[model samples]
Target: MPIKSIKVRLGLLSIIVLTGTMKTLGQANDTLLIRQLAPVTVSATRLEINEKRLPAALTVLGGGRIQIGQPQLSLFESLGGVAGLFAQNPDNFSQDLRISIRGFGARAAFGIRGIRLVIDGIPESTPDGQADVDNLDMGAMRRLEVMRGPSSGLFGNAAGGILNFQTENANEMSLLEGQVTVGSYGLRSYRFKTGVQKKKFQYVFIATRNQSEGYRALSHMESTILNLKLRYDFDSLTRISILANYGNSPVADDPGGLTLQQATENRRQAHPNNMRFLAGESVAQGRVGITFEKTMGKHLIFARAFGTKRDFANYLAFQAAGAGTINRTFAGASFQYQFSQKFDLIGYRFRLGMDVESQGDTRRRFDNLIGERGKLTFDQLESFKNIAAYVTQELTYQKVTMLVGLRSDAIRLHATDYFLTDGDQSGKRQFSRLNPSVGISLEASSKVNIYTNLGTSFETPTMSELSNNPTGTGGFNPDLNPQQAVNYEIGAKTYFSQRLRTDVALFDVEVKDELVPYQITGQAGRVFYRNAGRSRRQGVELSLNAVLAKGLTLFSNYTYSDFRYREYQTTTGKFDGNVLPGIPKHAAQAELRYFTPVGIFAIAQVRHASLLYADDANAVTANGYTVVNLRVGGQKTWGRMHIEPFIGVNNLLDAAYFQNVQINASANRYFEPSQGRFWFGGVKVGIK
Candidate 1:
């Protein structure tokens, strides 16, 4: 479909919706009151506190909204309405997904960087700030808390912001549920969940399997996930909890990017080299974690420990080193104590904590002979260690709150080479820093909050970024230094009435030595990192939720990002004042949903983005596009069973665009065409 036609249709539909329903209340008054009165949050301060009192830009997505008539295939589906956040690459399972918050993580070449990912208090990202969520099962997630802007003062390294995912705990009522779904591109999924509760014990188990013959050629993917959680309540003041998870992805093909001419010819065709070499990845990962919490008198104590292991193998076309195999082991622990006191009308809370984590990887690279390994090319052992201590204080004085925090971290990297035929190259590096932040929040009224914060953050290059140097070095790149930045932000969350609510935020960030990647000559798939002199980032975000009519709700979010380099010079040319690559300057998303008394529900969503640059030079551009999607579903209750049937159509207007782009890609191949219009339908059965 033409861009103009898509826009006109969407504009017409939106006008019709706005005119048809504009006189109804949002959720029940009681439910709204309960949610607004004392909603709790833990990600901002690392402790439970009222959401209105947190001096930071935070948003929470409840489970009900996340899973309502959704495919649950990627986080993009759940977080599309969040302001200042962008999720991409949902169709390319080989690379998982790309997430950028306020343009902080837009420089990533592969995997996640410059952000922290936490699940149930366990870090999914490595110490060096690299994360992959291919194994994450969205079915069991209960809630997500997103902390925007800089947060390293409390969370240590790579804390540009935090993505915290909380899992559902076993409830007092025993329950069992199962679901099966089939979708376009031969997609299929099955999931099962069960929970049990007793006097002193509770347990929950979840399992999921997903497979797809992807929309594009040579893009098949299959994965299985399992999770188990157990809790024992020794007493009212003490509790012990344990969690275990395992994931396996035997195959996830990499279709590779296509040039403009190629994409124009056939959007569904795979790169010729990718198909000839059978480029793909295979992965297995497992983790176990335990937590103990207790309260004694006026003091509270918390302790946690965790261990994880991963095995990964991948084949790439035209590889310099060869096929690769990586075995990684990671372990971490944390301890914290909190004290609270009250005097007259003032309340005080003091928290002190420490975290320690270590990771080691045994990496082997071999020459690629088409789809098979030809010979051993490189072998190395790489390790990273991090230790940090932090303290936070909160003061509450009648309708106002103040938060201050300080942290110190030490990180070390080590590498050992075993390929003696080349040379015995061993190297080590150490980095340490101290960060602090302060913020204040004011409750202007019963339904309004104003908050502001200032903080410092530092991010070190991940091992992959440091190891692959264009100069063909075997060890870490000594030229690359950690990036540092300072952030300033102000925001407000206001409820106009039971019918409407909104969140608005403005942020400014100044960065020094920003890490940037450049493609190496003759290495078609290789990239190297260098530090830019300085950079500036500023943005505004707004999100709204409103009730248009009795059973109709409207949600919309918009972001305006003005990000560029203040001083940067490359061998090719100067890039000062050029827009950052891979991020759009203007983006907006809107959705309208309706519910009926008979349990029928329908939703329509529209997403739009402005043009974006493909490289630091600003020579290549990817045009903006608009996409529309629609879904309808209903539930029916039987004597002992409940059934829900749903159907979804994506890209209803058949917009032609790229779902993912390779930033600064070599050879002018950058676009990864998005899947065209597709349809999916499924039914779920369970006891209600």
Candidate 2:
């Protein structure tokens, strides 16, 4: 069907549903009508402070809003339009999705290394503040909150910002929700969730099964997930909660980027035997947390502790006709305490907190090809700890508020490496840093605010960078040091008559001792981690939203980046200017939604990215591309049950492109190709 027709039909359906509901309410009791007409949100703030008064850059995605348009399956995809945020996934099954906030960690390959992800106050980042959201299940979430800029002082290690996924409170009677989807390339998925509440106890369970033939050959994947949460309230001021999650992913092939000739030949076909030569890894992760809260007259106290563990095995094919397997184990614990009061000196609200975290990682690599067989194996163990304390006081006077926070962090890093073949060992190294931040907000009116912030953050070297042994591909650099950054931002937000909203932000970041891989001669061209010269990145982000009429809404966001190196060390040991790699100059997204009378809705989305350099030397660049998507769905009531069905077309224009690339001196480049345009649709049901 045509996009315009879809929108027209959905608009009519929404009108019908609204009219019918109004008529039904007229016949019902006054109390019932009042209950049904109540405002939808009251939990925007965790505490008593008015949400409209908070001096922070925050965005909230409610569960109902998420279900209205039934946005993309990927949570990152759905977050595309948020200011200063960008999401890119090369393929559906790939664990490596690129996410950049305010130009931080834009070059990360696999997981987000600088951002912080939290769930119900449990820290999700590793000890050094690195986190990957590969295991997050968005279906069981009640809401998602994103706070940009350095939030490390509030939650340690959140240098880039913080993303919090809050699960539904199971204490609301009993409910069940599930969804089944089938689409192009034989794709299928099933997600089920159930929750029960009784007295002071509550429990929630979730399970998911997904499989797909994928858009490229040998790119098939199968995954299973399970989540369980339990909560108990001993008293009005005391509560305890526990959460556990497990996931398994088994799949084939790395749908690597292709050359120009290869892409022209066939975009859907994977390299020969890509599937047969593919073997996937299995990952399992879990966390446990405890919280305590107390109210003392005019003051409140909050404290929490948590521990997490993750295990994984990833296998890959090497160039020398050998397969390598990387086994990893990660574990960590964190604790924090906060004291706050609504009124203080100068009629200001003050909050002070301290956070401490420690984590350890162990990685083992096995190369079976060249061998002394098992004797040639390599192993490494690394550990890190972060300790930070901060105090934030928000002074409110009339319509103006000032938020000031100062934090200092002490980080300790240690590593040990062993080469099984020759009993060679590498020494350990340690590093530390301190960061601080300040912010301000001014309410120009009831619906408009202006804010600004300045902060400092740093990223320490990881175990992979400091301990990997040379195997013709890459070698470890034991002397690598930490990378440091300073960021400044100014932003404005406006809400027009509760029907339109807009936000804009400008940010600049400067860094020293940046980390980059350099190839060494005569050492089989092994890439080693080294500290690059100074660099700077600046960007502007704009977001706008409008509710057109009653059942139509539109949203859009755009970002422009200017990133370059002030001085970079080349192979000849000379300092030179070069542009940073993996950063696009421009990116934008727009989305439109329409509601119909038959409980149906339609949505259209478009995304565009400008050209980007693939190498630090600025010698290679990838062309830009644009993609479009369309989705249509509707909900119907069958007796006392509700059912919703949806169909979506991604990459409606069928544009072909590569998400990222690695350029080498030999003119041999490696690319991670993006999937072509595809179609998907699904059905969802709920019970209350």
Candidate 3:
């Protein structure tokens, strides 16, 4: 099938949607949160407040919208209509999902960086700001909240943004549900969920298995996951909750990135070297966390502790140090206290919190002898430890709210190289940083809020990045320095009516000593890091959520980003004024949802991305493209039993596009072609 490129008249569509919402009469705001009609509570900023009252840009998606007639593969499935957010590489199991918020995480080679991922008050991203979601049980996700812009003032280190997730809780008496799905390209999935609530004891258990031969050759992946949540309410103001999860992925293969010529010739074929080396990853991971909360008078206290262990192994495309294994263990704890008081018409809230975390890794590497490991090349023990404290104060008077926060972190990195033939590159380093932020929100009208914030972020290179050693030795990169960024943003939220709403924001970010990634010639999969002098990022975001008619709604967003290096100078050339690679200059998405009286529902989505560069020089570009997708489903209930069946078509227009681009890749290999016109369908049955 050949792909066709097209454009959408988004301005005209926006006008039509605005006109429809203007004529709707107030209907008591009793609609479900998924409709985006009711106000939502947001906790992504560490402060519980109304989404409309938060000074920062925030997006809250209810669980209902997240899983509606969709493949439970990635969070990108539900985040299409969000501004200033970009996600790609859903089919690349080795690299995981590549997500960037406001261009902060665009430098990542594998997994995510800069942004923080938190699930149920436990940090999913490590203290050094590295995250991998391959083991995450997305099937049990209940809610998602995204906070954009710098946020290190509250959440220490690499808090350029936040992704907060909540899993299903025992909200009802009992629930038992099962679902099985099969799709194109040998996709199979099975999921089961059960929950029960009795008095002060509640528990939720979820299990999922997903297997796929993938849309590309040598891209097979399979995983089995289990998640459990247990809670005991002691009292209304005092409670404790425990969460546990385990995941195993025995077969995950990497197709590897390809050049434009290679992708155009055959999009489904794996890289030749990747096939020869049997490139892929395998993992066994488990985690457990506990949380406690207590309230005394106008004061509240919260505590959390968690531990995790993972055994991982991977094979890369090259032979030198291509086979790698990691035995990793991590543990963390946090304590927080908040005080509130009211003085007539003025109110104040003070918060203080402390966190400590440690991670250790036993890493070893061997030569990849054409699908088999040969001799040991490198062996090392690496650890990262961090301790941090934060304090925040908030004051409310009349129609205005002001918040100020400060945080400081002490970080230490150590590595012990046991490969003595290499002269033993054992080393240690320490760093300390302090960040501060402030925000103000004004209620200009009952339906509008004007806000401004200035926030700062600090990011350290992950252990994997530090250990990549450009010299082909086994030690941390002594020259790689941490990056610091400051962001300023102003935004407005307007509720034209209960059926219509809009959010607009403008932001500017300045970075110093920005970390950059590049590849050496012989080491195909190895990524080496360097530092750029300075960089500047400016962007605008606009979003709209409108209930156009009774059962019809529209959610749309647009983003314009201009990111560039201001004073970057490398040994090769000066990169000043060059555009950042991997991120598009313009991106937009529009989604329409409709429901019929016959228990039928439909979702239509259109997304577009402007041309992007694959290298810092902007010499190589991937053409712009627009894609459409649709999902249709229906549900019915009969005698305590519920059933739903759905079908989805991605790339309905068969638009030619690249699903992922490897930035600054050597040998001009960057493009990862996307599948054209994929189909998926599934049925679910349950008793509640």
Candidate 4:
């Protein structure tokens, strides 16, 4: 269908919905019983806080809400409608989905940058607050909260924001849930979860196995994951929890970006001969934590401590049938204390926290020489440590609330180069920064609230930027300073008749000495890192949720952004004044759902994104595309068994488009295409 027709149809649908609201409401009330539900969130702070009352822009997705959407493949793709956030599926389910919050980390293909990710109060991101959630199982989650804007003063290095995932707990005695799905492309998946709770002791185990032939040729993947959680409460005020996860997956090679003509010619075929490449990743992680809470009359004290470790391995295939592997290890600890009413100040809350993290990575590059040829190998190692402390206070006076926070971070880094012609050597670098933030909330009325915030954040250079061998590219930079940014935001939240909720926010960020990676046209195009003179980013975000009469819900969001380099030199260091790459000028989403008797549900979603440049030089631009999706599902209960079957259609209109592009060394403009129209159906069953 043409874009014009799609828009016309959407308009017609909207008109029909509005015209028949009363009738539909009556039918919905008679056919399906529904009730008003309160919004749930946890990301505003470490504690459970009402989202409406929080002095920030927050988005929450409850477990039931997510499951109702019947997401077949990537969880990120399922959340494409969030304001100021974009989720892209480059190629079917073979690769990690690309997620960007306010265009902060769109460059990374396998991992997330400039954002902090946490699960069940344990930091899932690396020492610098970067994370990869490719292995996370959304089925076992209770809620997902997204906090946007500057948050370094609260979580440390979360320049963009934070994603907090809370897992389901065994609040009952025994429960067992499982799902088995089979769909197009030879896709098959199995998820099993079971938990037992007895008094103060509770345990839950989850396992998943998935395999797919993918929507494209040679794009096949197989992954297995296991998660275990155990919790014990020694007393009413003390608790201990332990969690572990292990995952492994083999991925197909990138088909390389395609042009418009190429995408139309062969939507299911990858680049010729690309099947010879093979790569995979594996992860092992675990965490142990304890919480203590005590109350004395008007005073309350809360404390927590946690230790975590993550191990990673990555293998890449290169030319001459040679291969290389990268290994990384991370360990961290955190401590926090919260004191309430310490001085009898009404509605006063104070919190202090500290964190320490150590990380190291080793890379081994090798080549397979021909017969009678000698094999060559080289190795490099890099290590880094980060320490941070923060303090926060919140005071509520009547309908006005104020929050103030301050944080300090210290970083130490070291690099050791071995197997080099110059012999073994070591280098060190250090950096520190202090950040502060303040926010205010005013309750304009019983159904409306206004909020404003001003905050500062800093981003430290990654180990890859500091110590990676630059011989092939431009050689590593031994001296790199942390980037600093100031963010300002204003927003308002309004609730209408307790049925409709809306939020609108405007924000701008200015960065000084921003680190940017660029390529130099000297000695085979070497890649190096440099700091941009300056940059500015501004945007507006709007989100709305409506619970219409009769088991119907509507959610919509839109964002408009203006990102550019304020002062940059193109000649001296290959940096020029240009629009930042990968950031869309405009994005929007709309979703509608209807619930019916017999436990049946139907949903439709539409998404749109504007054009964006592919490279820093602005020589190539990728055309934006709009997509539509549809889903239908039903559930039935039979005695001790319950079964739910769902079917979903993505890219319903089959609009062929590219998500990103870049100028590669081959002088070819490679583009990553969005997934074509695909269909999937699955069933989930539960046993008690």
**Model 2 over residues 1-688: C-alpha lDDT tens digits?**
4434554554464444434432121122234222222223322223334434555566666664454435234576567657667666536454456676765666554566667777776766676656766566767677777777655555544367767777777753138878876666666778888888888888999888877777776567776777788888887877777777776665533554455566668866654423333433446666666666666655667677776777765544332322334444444443333454454444555556666777777666554332212333556566777677667666777677666666777767665555445554645555555566677778888778888888777777665556543442222465577778887888887877666777787888888887765433322112356677798878888878776655667778888888788878766554456667776789888988676544656789898988887667676677898989888766666454566667777888878787555333122334556676667666667776
Candidate 2 achieves a global lDDT of 0.63
Q: Rank the candidates by lDDT, best first.
A: 3, 1, 4, 2
How many pairs of residues collide in model 2? 10
For each candidate, give its TM-score against the true structure: 0.94, 0.86, 0.95, 0.87
Q: How accurate is candidate 4 locally (lDDT)?
A: 0.67
Lowest lDDT sum, 10 consecutive residues, model 1, at 21-30
**Alpha carbon lDDT of each predicted model:** 0.83, 0.63, 0.86, 0.67
Q: Model 3, 234-258: lDDT tens per residue?
A: 9999999999989899989998889
Report how far off residue 134 is in candidate 2 (Å): 2.7
How accurate locally is residue 397 in candidate 1, as Cα lDDT from 0 to 100? 99
lDDT of 4 at 544: 85
Off by over 4 Å in 1: 1-40, 172-174
Q: In what order do the candidates fall by TM-score, top score first? A: 3, 1, 4, 2
Question: Which regions of candidate 4 fall more than 4 Å away from where they truly are?
Answer: 1-41, 90-95, 172-174, 259-265, 272-317, 320-322, 342-345, 368-377, 473-476, 518-528, 572-577, 659-666
lDDT of 1: 0.83
